[model samples]
Target: MTTEHTGTPRPSDAELARIAAELRALGEPEFDAELEATPVASLVRELAVPTAFALAFGPTDSALPAGAADPAGAGGLLDVAPLTELDRARVWRKIVARRSGGAAQHHGPRAPSWRATWVAVATAAGLALVPVLSTPDRAATPAGRAAAEALGSQARAALEGVPGEQDGGRAAELAAQYSARLSSSGSEAPR
Candidate 1:
């Protein structure tokens, strides 16, 4: 039977359940053949790329801050004028004020809590770790090994990434060396 175009609306849950029951009534077909045609791996690959980008940079609508007047998201990103800069600074100042003990005054003082102390310590530790984890040195591949890799080595790059099983002490040493160099050079360090 030919089905008419019904304004392109999705089928209701009840309709979907009825259709599913009917499909089940017909003895099991080879799902393997249908799955091979539209493999789950290919489906995941199609969806995962978009999902990763979304998680990394957030949605297009979210690129703009809340209470922004623009509906079309027009003009260049930098064209938001002084509003963007001031808004960012305003948000950052509030974050600093709240984290510092200013929020306690607003909410009225209470006994010092260990949970807040633990959270503050954890946050500080995570922030300290960011710089160390951001830039990683690629393990020095042996000179002989470089030629093999350059000329199509059989070794595939692992999903877990380049396995640099270095001791944590080595990372600490690198950080110390970098800090010493900065102190000696008097670069004033980056903002």
Candidate 2:
């Protein structure tokens, strides 16, 4: 039955889902007799030449073909001189250079800057201090005092173990003793 146009607005999601379900219920469509009889190869052969011509010459329906020969000698591509051997070599070199990242290297490596050096130094210093910062304050603890005494004893033993006479053995021994005392006293001030 022919229904007159209702001029309805866009269908809702529900309407669309219903339409889709109806379409899915239908099996594969049967081609008309004429279309069924037409060979695909024959169609391709018929259109191939025209398609190639249209592609090469641009759209055929236009009044003048695209890139049509300029009449007033506006210096089209045909007028240009062929590349010389040197020109060809230069072009090839440029292409190879670009492919090999040589084009990027034209500016060369960046020179070391004072700011970058300072940043690197600061980073290294921060990294060096990380262990020191992460460790808990041990100077006030009894364990720290025992550790300092052990270190001082080890240092004295190490000094005695040396075969040759030390230049400032007395001074070194005194410094070790002082360091141990300072560690046990929980004194933050540098001696």
Give the number of the best model, judged by lDDT.
2
Q: Write the per-residue lDDT of candidate 2 for residues 147-173, one digit (tens) a residue.
A: 988999999999888775355986788
lDDT of 1 by residue, 1-191 (tens): 11112333223322322222222222113322332222121211111123333444453422223223223322221222222344334433433444344335324353256557888999999999998899787666799568877655434545237654457977988877888888888876723
Q: Best TM-score goes to which candidate?
A: 2
Clashes of 2: 0
Model 1, CA-based lDDT: 0.38
> Estimated TM-score per prediction?
0.17, 0.20
RMSD of each: 32.9, 26.8
Looking at model 1, the pairs that clash are none
Candidate 2 Cα misplacement greater than 4 A, ranges: 1-75, 102-129, 132-191
